[model samples]
Target: MHTTALVLFSGGQDSTTCLAQALSKYERVETLGFDYGQRHHIEMDTRRVVLANLRERFPQWAPHMGEDHVLTLAALQQLGGSSLTDEVAFAMQADGLPNTFVPGRNLLFLTLAGALAYRRGLQVIVTGVCETDFSGYPDCRDDTMKAMQIALSLGLERRLLIETPLMWIDKADTWALAHSLGGQALVDLIIEDTHTCYLGDRVHRNAWGYGCGTCPACELRQRGWARYSARDANASSSP
Candidate 1:
């Protein structure tokens, strides 16, 4: 059984929720992020903000929250065909994946996280890669995570579990999970602090969060918020 975790936190909704989930389950939890030369670099800032908020507001999780590490991978921008790293429009490719799909992004993140975990003496790696309501990113799939887990364990010569709490859930369910973990406070933090825009637009704030509302990331968040809020409202009104 894994008692300690290193969460791949991007300072986004899914990642923040994953951090909460890990803190709830593990005895100790650390966070890791990557500065992958994304056009939307605000995540690097928002991630820290989110971590600070969690530590301050949630006393139960404060002690377990440990050191946070960030890595800069300049190579992604150098090899970029994706809109996330380059000055390009978002569109689907002939291969059926979105232009926003950064090739080998999750894979590389996990590999590096594994190395960091080894150095830091962590037991498991947690990420918030969901597939049930995602934009068809192969790296976010269940099979890909499973394969990566096996590879990391074998390469490290030690058993390391890869935990994906959001893998089987959709966006609305993700919202519900956040509520369960940290209640309305966490939901408010996600809405006010987490950054998920592909364009990194922070000036315009929406009901869900800050982002270019039309971007795939924002669209999913907005849609999920609509469903979650509607359901919560109905539940509250029920006798």
Candidate 2:
């Protein structure tokens, strides 16, 4: 078991769940976020609020939560082509990948995270990347994660483990995992506080969370909520 962990937290639903899990399992867990010039800056904006709430709401995990690091990587905007790094409208490319696919976002995030984890003497790096029910981002694949873990350990000259708790789970299962980890309080915290809309639209709120309810992220989240709620309803009616 790893004693120390650094979560690649984005203040979104997935990352927040990962953070909660890290806090529960690790003796010490820190968070690392990147300012990659994303068009939707709400995720970055809400990081502090989420952390504060975690400390306030979950006393058990509060002692384990440690330092938070935010790195500014302006180079992403400089190398812009994707919708996230650019001012272009979101669309599907001829190659079938969404315009929101920032070419090297996850790869770059993991590399910087490895460097920071090495400096911080962290034993594990936790991330929210998922292969199932994701937008087909190749970087989120289990194979990609496995390869990155090997590469980071080799390059950093440290025995580092990359933990992807959400790797094989879809969004509904993700909600179920959160409920298992921290129960209804956590589920409520995630729905009310987490931000996942690509547009950073917090003006509109839904049963699942605050989002635009149309973007890929919002759609996935809403779909997951539907399934999760259905299961809950069925379970309640069980004999």
Candidate 3:
């Protein structure tokens, strides 16, 4: 029997890529999405829609894959300092941390994911956090994830493998992986349908992907899209 794994899903580019990666590796894979009082529910809604589509494509993906287990981290509202769960108006800092950084976000999410894994006898929890994309956010760093892994192991009293397949890869590589896993069809759907805008605006996005292009999230995404496009252009032109 293949070992079951749980994914820390968010229905965005990174997490969606991670989810697709999980689909390829594990015999059974369940997704864990949190309703942490976000400013908007578009991301969660996107998760539902994407998973539903995936189910149609891969019927064997999740009946025993915990289709009913999309957990909610509602308590994140109580522990808010970032703009995600707070009403505080955030100004775009030119150099320092952006207001989009949610304190203790990955930490809390990973802990809950670990507990869920332990309870369900699943040993792997996969997330798509990247140090290169969102380096401004301290939580996205490799050190932060390592620390959380240790903490979760101690708390759960069991060995758990927290998979970070996209941690070291950049957005361009992520797009490449998406293409490899689910083909250009899935990759196109992810690009056109997924939501990653920090301001929660998808309808008003440019060619670089969704989100307010001025925010840090959009900046990274837009740059990556450009880089990927250029790389593809060069590759096609090469002998």
Candidate 4:
């Protein structure tokens, strides 16, 4: 039986890395991207381009790269308090939780992914939610993922494995993981093509993906790239 996995891809650095890792491990890999009425809806465009690039560059994995699914949850915008779904400006620190923290976003995404996985007879679902170096999103934690896994399994009446490859790893480690999975090609794809910017400004390209350079997501990515580059430089200088 061929091992099949579904990836909850967002076309950002972390999810893109998770997708690459899935292609490396799974016999058949399908990706699901959400259109939750986010301000940075260009992420879907990036996802398409990334998938196309992967299929072209890594033809060996092309057979396993199953069809990609894009689901729209536009109602989340109607039910919005989050800066991501609302017209509110993105703010890093506002009160206890960040304004960008879309309530139940990850939960809904994972649940939907699980439903799709169960329907397709897939037992493994990969997500890129990271606890380490994460913003104040509560759903990105390991406990939440575990609980969601159990809920999905019980609800679907099928044992489901939720794979969080970037769960404990920080952004710098995420970069290293991408490099390990697909070498410089993957790394370059992430840097040059993937969209991680919350503001969706493709004009301000950097070592990291195109970002506005001020949002929390961009800050974390920039910091991670700086750390990763420094480490690489030091290693190159070493014996």
Candidate 5:
């Protein structure tokens, strides 16, 4: 039987890397993106662009890059506590979690992904939720993912492998993994095209995709790029 996988893609740097990894491993890979009424709704457009580029640049993987399914969760906007989904200003709490953290967003996304996977008879569901370097979102924790996996399995009555490729790795390691999967070209695609900014500002380009440069998401990405660049420079200079 051909192995099929569903990726919970957000069209961000980490999720894009997860997509690359999925394409490398699975025979058939379908992407699931959410239109959860985020302030950065531009991510949906970015996801489409990335998928198109993948098909155009790597025709060999085109067959594996199955459908890109986008689900609209407009209710998230109505709930309206998160800066990402609401008109509120983005701010980080004393604990480091920004207001951009949508409540139960990942949980809802994973549950929906589980339902899709169960109906499609897929055994694996890939996500880009990283514990390290993540902005204090409880849903992104490894423990949370494990618990969700158990709950999802019980709820669906089907065993599903929740793959978190970026769970343990930081953003810099994520960049290295993306490079290993498809080399510098993939890396460039992610840096230049993927949208990670909370502010949804794509006009200002930086080392790490377009962003306002002050949001937590952009800060983490920029720091990761700096670390990755330094490591690359050191490796090149070494005897």
Candidate 6:
């Protein structure tokens, strides 16, 4: 009997790392993606590619089993507020949550994922939410996740574990862990392949991927990349 796990996959750096980690741990790993009508449709495409590659690598893992994780794209488009789904321009908030916060997004996604996991008899669900590098999203915090876990258990009548492997890890540490786990190839694939910009820009200039590097997301990404590259270079140069 395989231990199945559901991954709340976003096809981004953290989520992709979580996917790889889940692959290493669970006998059967399933993914759940949302078409939350994000401004960047590129993410959805990236998710498809990630899934395809996973299937190519792990032929025994059923590729993408279960129902299509695609939710109602129109409803999300209709619901505004978050920059990801709405026409609102992204603004970098120096403090507090930003416009990118999709209200109740993770809650809804996890609730659906919980249902899926329960249906598949899987007790574990994995997500890539991080508190360290997270952009002040309330749902990314540990407390929020704990509360959601309780709510899910009570409301859904299912005992499921929402595993957040990168909840406390910063981006630099995430890169280090990926390098340590023979996931350098995967990391490179994601860095070069997936899109993470709140503005949907995807070109690395001055060691920045996605976004204009001037934005908060880009600033953090640039810092993380610099740290990782410098450490990796120093390690290589050392005798």
Model 4 residue 151 CA deviation (Å) reads: 0.7
Q: Rate the local accuracy (lDDT) of all candidates.
A: 0.94, 0.91, 0.79, 0.89, 0.89, 0.73
Candidate 2 vs candidate 5: the TM-score winner is: 2
> Model 4, poorest ten-residue lDDT window?
86-95
What RMSD does each model have against the real structure?
Answer: 0.8, 0.9, 2.5, 1.4, 1.5, 2.9
What RMSD does model 2 have?
0.9
Better of 1 and 3 by TM-score: 1
Residue by residue across 1-239, what tens digits does model 6's lDDT show? Answer: 34778888877777777877777777777778888677777788877877676556545444434333665546656778677777767775556778787778888888888877777777788998888987888888899888888888888787778889999888888777766644566666666655566666655444534566665566777788888889889989999
lDDT of 5 at 133: 80
Record all residue pairs in model 2 with backbone atoms less than 3 Å apart, i.e. clashing: none
Question: Over all chains combined, what TM-score does candidate 4 have?
Answer: 0.96
Q: What's the TM-score of each model vs. the native?
A: 0.98, 0.98, 0.89, 0.96, 0.96, 0.86
Off by over 4 Å in 3: 58-68, 87-95
Model 4 shows how many backbone clashes? Answer: 0
Cα lDDT tens digits, model 4, 1-239, are 33999999888899889988888888989999999889999998988899999899878778889978989998788898888877777766656788899888899999899989988878799999988898868999999999998999898888999999988889999999999989999899999889988888899878776989998789999999999999999999999
Clashing pairs in 4: none
Residues 130-186, model 1: lDDT tens digits? 888999999999999999999999999978899999999988999999999999999
Q: 4 or 5, which is superior by TM-score?
A: 4
lDDT per residue (tens digit) for residues 105-199 in model 3: 88888888898888888878899888776657788888988888888888878888888898878988888888888887777768777878767
**Segments in model 2 whose C-alpha atoms lie over 4 Å from true places:** none
Worst 10 residues of 5 by lDDT: 86-95
Model 2 TM-score, all chains together: 0.98
Q: Candidate 4: RMSD over Cα atoms? A: 1.4
The Cα error of candidate 1 at residue 25, in Å, is: 1.0
